[model samples]
Target: MYLYFEFAKPKMKKKPNKNTHKIHNYEYYTSGRYIDYISRPSAVYIQNDNENRTTLLAEMDSKKLNVNLFMKSKLLINQLSEKHIDGYGFKEESKKLEGKTGLHKLFEKNLIDIDPKEAKEEFKKLENNNQFIWEITLNPGQLGIDNQMVDKNEWNEILNKHMKSLLKANKLDPNKIEGYWALHSNSKYPHIHLGFFEKETNHSNNYRQSGKFSSKSVERFKYLFENSIKTQAEYQNLFSLKNSIWNNRKEIKELFLSTIALKNKQETKSYEALSANELKILNASKVIANFYKNSKSKSYAAAKNNLEVKEAINDIYEAIVENNQKLALAVTKYKQEFESINKAKFSDKYSAGLKDEFVANEKDEFEKQIGNIIVKQCLKMNAKEKEVQTSLNYQEKDLKQDFNDDELPIGLSFYPYKYDEISKLKRMIRSLNYEFNRLSRSQKFQALRKYKKNISGVKSKVIL
Candidate 1:
């Protein structure tokens, strides 16, 4: 089970008012665990075989203390130091056992720094020095935790490392704060109780007004404790999975770069010379062009929402993957490793469903990355095609200008013919015009008369 945590401030009471209610003013000094446990006794005390356990009957029979104790620090320390609390006073493997004499002192922090008598006097001197209390509970039967797996030293170390993080998360200054914690070893669930307050009271508004630790602080500590108790083998498995994911990402990135390079290489080639995969990419580019024309945003997210754009992207992605065997192998290996680790660790139906959901999320992220790459490549190709078309249009305009120039004959004009035929026609027309201009007036007349005589001769022969 996951770690459970709860927080609270000292009990508060409403100020006396006849007409309107005022805010409840919290007390600075109160008995800590004894007051809480007596009010709500939830857990059953189970006696273990090896150790001399404290009987629940003794707790019920003990005289109760006044609810409103004036000396809060002394009462709090005495309650925390109680010997009958399970896992608090006794060492685990000690053979010298008795009813309650063999119990060890509870492990404590920062409390020993201040004398209880002096702390109680100091508490009385302050007006608004309220403290916050919280507890962390864990079940020993959980998969990653057990009685032997964690000890006082480990808990102390983990808490010490994250204490500052917790304080900062809750907007408290670590330097100004003083705190204490004690771990109680119940047979079913071991838990720790902690409380903290400012050493010298400051009337600053930066402190949390909610009087409770933030959820961020709770989650941070939970993660810290969970990671601390993880076994070496679990760490190795997690490291291997992360390495596989890194390799998979690298392979995908390389595949995208290579595809872009290939497109650039084939940009100048004629349509007939392109291979099947290249042709498919070219068609995909046109689809992407239309997508950009109609869509407001050219982002991959918007592209994937359109059916035509989605299919085009998938087709291009599949084509590239088919041709790149390394990428295919890397992706397959990553998925297999992920599933293998998850299955080995979690075998129940609910865990299986969670694993499936994780895999789907990973797949969606990968597809989004690949889709963005495809869109970029297609846009590049479309730009190159437009550039080539613009160049051809300019050349055609120049050719039309040459044919319609005033130096040429009036009947000569531009025609949509092959380059060679157009060049030959221009040459023939120029030559005939040059010869006609070079002839003198009388010589031109003589040539015209000769042309008419030849036409008349042909007509007479036909009549005959």
Candidate 2:
């Protein structure tokens, strides 16, 4: 799951600024004073002015500063670069524009070919008004990303790969795309700030014309990033867990089918004939029947929308989980492994809230899958039941028609033995009709022919 993944909306300006000023602003805010202000322990500073030199130092004399004034002073000084006597300001070393303390070097597709400072100047020289600035923030601690896991080189590679992907997603040629990114580490939550524009502007591209990045593009980037970061083992575990959940769902469906079959059997038997296990299945089938009766719509989407139907589905799902030990165990294991992976990637120390959100999201997805399976199975059973009922109705109609014969011997009642024989033949014909109705269509034609021939012989014998 993603840990505190944030894609800031792409910044667009109605009136473009000077390229020099834009590049400077992007660099200064993304990797310079912005980082210093957020990472600094305190805003309080003291100015030491003497004949020799003037230096700004972090204040050591806490007793001399008012806490309330310090906060208000910090708030008043919006720009961290601004000089302040009692609020946050860049230190002497931090003031150097070339210093890397708060400034991360810019990187591109080929790291060796581009010098960080020179790239900034080159980007400034680009004559494009359609340039876009994008920002992505990833909490390292939460993402289980430490320096050891992803070094600077690997991070640059990952960024480069995703940059190409992003360009292609926007319908721009990757080969012609020019972009630079800086991975800022000064803040607790490390982030990447990227600036890019097509070298040869493609006005035909919808993204360029609209000047908006699609949400699909952002989500794709996140997916790519997450996959790239996961270890092979982690990936395998996730794959296995997914398959297990699917298998469990299938098992639940089979259980429902078995219970449905048991219910059909019970319908044809007396209560005393049902064994304990059969009775249990019969009771379970009744619960399913109740769900169908109460549901206004058999559609899974509709069922989810209706609170009552949703609750009934959940209740049935929970009961199945509870009763089937293997299914219950598999479900428990899946949740545990899922939560474990989440915690490993997004440590609780940095992303407790995000971790919880991801876990809940996974749970919702699982339940939706199970719910869909149940709805489909139930609908299938309902269709089969209707089919069986229709066949019975047809059989009853055939029975009535077969019995209404216009050509019966007129004096059959006068001969008592002949009347009894004719009555026996009628009963035999009824039995043959029942057996024929049960036969397959292929077998039914032949069975009907045989029954007709037998009936004709019986009628002739009785008449004689």
Candidate 3:
């Protein structure tokens, strides 16, 4: 139920009135969880041309609204059509229904009361569609121009490139995917909201499907948003006359037709039983994959399953793990390369030089960007090594506290189960410690801003 709507009234040539031409907003979503109201909010706006026509005034990103999916539930996107848009909806809607009504209305209702001293509970009740879910948000003014976002001027070419590449890969028809352009400037920083329809409907909005949209029901909701912005932008002339994005229809269409991460036929592989040799090959491949993922040692992983042919599998695995000591050294080397940049760049004195270098050299810029990925791999390898070392340490400790079952496999302990039970204590300790660290980090980062605010307040007061 994560949704974002931002309005940008033209800041350049055309400015619209925020006062005279007001926007009526409606919102929809299922609510749960206490996301920081100040931190998390989605905005979409309506553009309006002022009566004076001189200022071309508008209220861009003036307000934000948040919706949650657990307690306070909101839905009703399929409701908007030409016949019934409800111009005077909110006042009448609440009288019509008691709780949050539509998408835009949820924003207005949320803004009514605020207790800055505490975080308010917007969630009315908890509902379950439980799984590991994550979300990201962007305000028009706040969203940075990069590869992650479609930069306005650079967007056309980027979109076109993606379209051409995808078309060559999938052999898709441009007409099958429809594209529309809209500039909603009724908000702070002017932004263009381009909508692309897949034309093909997804079967599992009911949940349990691979290759889903950015949001669970992102496509449908985005369309409703797109149409709303289109109507509003056209009425207000939020688009620029000189630098209009209107003419790039061909490029825009290509972007719309580009590959979507979501699809109906998610799994394209055939289902069949594997033979004995095939199974062994699969197992070897799986082990190598897991080792690479867990070890971060590409050398170890590559040697394990370097060649795909049947004869080479064993030889490859042996070659890869030929000597564990050598493999470990290679891992250390790679790990050092990964950390050398960041740890150096972030240091107090050296950081200034690193920053200056970054400004001057594209190589430094590229390295800084990818350095985290290298470090992440190194950390994963270290974690795997720690796990193995911890396991070995526990086994040695267990041997000392042997059980009474002397009749079993060689050094049979006094009791088999007793030895096993005592041995796991170290592992349990490590597991608990790992969880504690993760939770502590989460709490600290989330509240860091609030702590700074308090510190600033204390410093500013007159202490005569």
Candidate 4:
């Protein structure tokens, strides 16, 4: 995930000139005059101070700091040795396998000398548990307009400084968070890949026990890196020029707008297929938001009579039943225990409200009070119960060829005797499609096993 920070506009003139009746001279930051200002010699006069730092930030297309953070239980040595290190810009030409310096060398050079025997012994302690291998990418972008402009040696030095600062800020020891890093310059956006396995540090006074970066720490790292980059004279000027050119380009703006539209369309479609629990909360919220519009009387029964309100209640009830059986059972028990009391309470409230004449504001307040109770109950029951199932199975009937063919496929298959079984299978397939559409990329990746199995096979067939 990326972390974003809004840069402060210290140059912004908040007040207008009273005598001259002139507007605030906020030309340094305004997007409209940005192109014109940059084109003229006057822009050179604008000093690179705290005031225009935000303008520099605004000019950049890639505003947020990106850290592609990953943690795996498997060690990096095995992963790298097995040729499993794909997509991290590891080249085939420079690759070494047998008797070469591997991930272990990173420690010796950058942090500490980790003896192979000692490291293996330490790893054995948490061999079966979540012994993590952290893989991270920092500042995955072009150094300058032309990659040639950046000095590789200087860039590496600055990068190392920033990375160490980030680690120190997050309470990670350079020795403990040891990893191998390689800068891949072949790509347009030059990036570095860092890989390391977690080691138990006996020096509790120095290193963090977990050797982990929390979300908050990551956010802090993002800010620190951005500030560090800005503070450096070489990078600040290079990036400022590049970003101004990028943001002022017409094609970039058009591309961004088109991308945003497509994203909005996709999000709308996904939002339509919300989870049962989400739908309940959404419907309830809508009902509460529009409570004042309906219900002329201050009566709870009057508010309940509204179709939207009634539907919202029904949705909430269904959500509660589906989400939490225990909560539903408790409510069921409450109804049984205070059956007479609830009935009497309802009658009293209805009679009292009907008999008295309340103003529109009072009626609105009364409606809110009644709606609040129902919404609260629904919300209380809407907690998601953890699902621990490992597999999701769905069957597909192979209708590509003749069903009675002798030369058939080779996989376990079954024939359903009853019509309801076929119907159930169809329903299962439909549900899978619905879920696949609604789910995020990560969810789909996790559920790929089910899709891979269900998509290609048919029941009642076995051919090799």
C-alpha lDDT of all candidate models, in order: 0.50, 0.46, 0.31, 0.38
Candidate with better TM-score, 2 vs 3? 2
**TM-score winner among the candidates?**
1
The C-alpha TM-scores of every prediction are 0.39, 0.31, 0.16, 0.24
What RMSD does model 3 have?
Answer: 29.1
Residue-pair clashes per candidate: 1, 1, 53, 4
lDDT order of candidates, best first?
1, 2, 4, 3
Q: Which residues of candidate 3, in runs, are more than 4 Å off?
A: 1-34, 37-211, 214-230, 236-464
User: What does the lDDT come to for candidate 3?
Assistant: 0.31
After superposing candidate 4 on the true structure, give the runs of residues whose Cα lies further than 4 Å from its correct spot: 1-130, 142-150, 203-212, 227-464
- Over 343-451, each residue of candidate 1 has an lDDT whose tens digit, in order, gives 6553344544555665556666767777787887777778877897798788879888667546555655454344455565756775564445334423654665577
lDDT of 3 by residue, 1-464 (tens): 12343222112122322332322111111132212212122322211111111122211112222212100111222112213367677555444333212111111212122231222222211122221121213223433111112112222333333333332243333344433222222233434333222333335433212223333234444343333333333322222211122223223223222211111123422113443443333344433344456454454223322222112234222323232444434434433433343243322334345434533443333322222222333344446557877987787669656533454455434432344544455446645754564456446645754665566544211100
lDDT by residue (1-464, candidate 2, tens digit) is 33222121225323323322333344443343333432232321111122101011123124343332322233212234556564334555234322222223333433332334554555455323344433344433445232222233445666677757866787767776655544444333344445554556566543345435667886788777655655422433344455554565465556655544454454555444655554443343334545667667655555443343454455556655566676567667666666564665532223445445655566666666667765665566566777977987787667656553345455333222234666656656755743453344326535655666667544211000
Among all windows of 10 consecutive residues in model 2, the one with the lowest summed lDDT is: 48-57
lDDT of 4 by residue, 51-94 (tens): 23334334332434221111111113332433444644455412
